[model samples]
Target: MKSNPNFLFPKLASTIEELRQLSISEERKKVLRPLVLYIQRCVQESKTCNLNFICTHNSRRSQFGQIWAKVASEYFGISANCFSGGMEVTAFNERAVESLKRSGFKISSKGKGNPIYAVSFSENSDPIVCFSKLYDDRVNHVENFAAVMTCDHAEENCPFIPGAEVRIPLHYKDPKEFDGTDLEEKKYDERSMQIASEMFHVFSEAEKQG
Candidate 1:
């Protein structure tokens, strides 16, 4: 695969290896198939492939999904826009931010409770701007995008996301369950890698087929 400079960062480089090592399960593929097809269709039609990942809190999984998806798309040279939002606004947890740093994203933040983070996966590529906000927040694309539910709570609660051309359920186990425990870091990194793996699979598959 032609590599992107951001993906080549030593910290993120290990993550690329981890993602490559993962074998996408059939169950996971079931969720990803529709997303891949949707992205491919967008490309074929010359439309923007925007993806917005949603969760109840938007502190963790949704944030990871959005960042990794954008990074993977850049790696594979797909022109996809990715974002994350929650049903309720919460600060993007520091723990979650720590996990991303551990995964090799160079991160910086401003503000206190609701800090906006500039997360860089590579030097040559644009950083993924991250924060927690409502799904309908002005920062997110309101139209011609897919609503990807990263948590079951969000998928079940938000049955009617307006302006979403497609809705895809790509749930992940919340690592927040282990927060404040000894395994918190492990669980967070595990969740991050899982999302990174799937995103790599999605973008890689789209590139192959398109």
Candidate 2:
């Protein structure tokens, strides 16, 4: 695999550079270590690294995880398949979508209740198609995948993920708590950037291990 900085849109690339500069706490790094090791093992075995980011609602943190993991792996020249799902289906939160847009991603959506979003960080690569669905959704890889629990609720609720080769709990605070308040956007963007920073860190370490 070859690094493809050219695959990202110019503005998104700039944003990602900024995210890389953000700090990851030791505690957070410990949580992300398993993920880094998983990617390295995949690299060693010449296997595709498949990740499924799951949450209770599938609307916020999980979505961020899936998108950033995909971007992080691609940016580091790793081959990976990334997906997101939840215990229950719900639309991807609009606030989270706006936060991603502010981070320079190009996103568009279609459908009614739970719209399918086409999210793109790169001009050259195909956009990631995102929607709310069950963890076992047909669109996701059935086996040979890592199950990344991005919320405390989901981690506790999902005792067993049938096809997961490994289960990693990487919980993030919900920005949904600020939904109707004055701090909504700030909180959402904060959470989004936090996720982005950590994900980039994970893949950066994985790349080194490779």
Candidate 3:
């Protein structure tokens, strides 16, 4: 990992600046504390943090968690690898993709049914490869990684992840409920920004620990 990740594209940087202004509730901060400590441990040990964000479908909230966590790690100059997965395979939701684009992410995708998206926040950093698969997919770290459950369903269904060093429940509300409605874009953007803000908080706390 780059010691100091490259500067984000101007638009993305602006979006992140906006996210930084959002306030996280104390209750929510309590829920996020475990993740903060997990990253702090990695920082203290000089270990590369591997985060696997898991949800039921691996389409919406989980993807946001994966993307924002990676961005936050980079912003804080933390060595981290972020991944997202689900209990069942599905395509990354298009609405979520559009919301990310609105936030200034540069994405290119290929394949038919389940296109793989290459998502980038900075010009020099390699794009994060995103698609839907199980949490234990070969592409993800096999052990010594944090299994961050991003949805209630995944946390309930997956009681044990064989290789995970810690399982943290950092659940997020699904924006999929607003799909096909006038509020679709609004809700997706809200959830995406919410996740982005929270991830930034987590990394910021970890950086403070260092």
Candidate 4:
């Protein structure tokens, strides 16, 4: 792993390569490829491609999106910053952290009572940290970045994001539906794998262009 101060954490080269082999949806692949390439070009040119993944809870889908984007960008030799936030005030859910860990993401617990566990893809990458804040908490703060809505609710409700240069809707189903069930872990893992697979496919397409 190599570190980049301008970016949050260093890129995890190996993991990104590994993820490129995972299986995912064709529809997702179709959209993610060109989008990722555009993002990568922006970052490589020293432009800040600030990506904000937003969901209703910001516990699972958006969190996964944020982490995978960071890992994918690093693997493809792209420079970009990634963050995750929720439409409502909610801490990073423990199940999501556990799921990511199981998927081989190197994570660390930073604050008391787990404090949402600051997650990073590799030692050099900055942890996917979050504040228990709302999407609109600091109106003008994230104005120049891309506003990516990762769930249906957030995408529909947040039609207008202040200061956002581009608004993209990338929706995923809530894996929380399996919470408390006997197969909860399996379901989370499945969801995580799906996300990982899609991200890899996106970057693989980007790699082909060069």
Predicted structure with the largest TM-score when compared to the true one: 2
Which stretches of candidate 2 lie above 4 Å from their native place?
A: 1-3
- 1 or 4: which has the higher lDDT? 1
Q: Could you estimate the TM-score for every candidate? A: 0.95, 0.97, 0.97, 0.80
CA displacement after TM-score superposition, residue 51 of candidate 1 (Å): 0.3
Report the C-alpha lDDT of model 1 over 1-210, residue by residue, as the tens digit.
354644457868876887779888897798799999988887777666999999999999999999988988888877888999999999898998998888888999999989999998777777889999999899999998999999999999888999899899999999989988999999998888889999888888887787
Report the C-alpha displacement of residue 63, candidate 4, in angstroms: 0.8
Q: How many residue pairs of model 3 clash at the backbone? A: 0
Query: What does candidate 4's lDDT look like per residue over 57-107, in tens digits?
Result: 777888787787776667666556777778777767788888877666667
Candidate 2 lDDT, 1-210, residue by residue in tens? 555677788888888889889988898799899999999999989989999999998999999999999999889889999999999999999999999999989999999899999999887889999999999999999999999999999998889999999999999999999999999999999999999999989888988887
Please give the lDDT score at residue 172 for candidate 1: 94
Q: Cα lDDT of all candidates, in order?
A: 0.88, 0.93, 0.92, 0.68
Deviating ranges (above 4 Å) for candidate 4? 1-18, 40-46, 110-116, 136-141
TM-score of 2: 0.97
| Span of ten consecutive residues with least summed lDDT in model 3 | 1-10
C-alpha RMSD of candidate 4? 4.4
* Error of model 4, residue 192, in angstroms: 1.3
Candidate 3 off by > 4 Å: 1-6
lDDT (10s digit) by residue, model 3, range 1-210: 223434998899989889999999999999999999999999999999999999999999999999999999999899999998999999999999999999999999999788999998998899999998888899988899999999999998889998899999998889989999999999999999999999999999999886
**Alpha carbon lDDT at 133, candidate 2:** 95
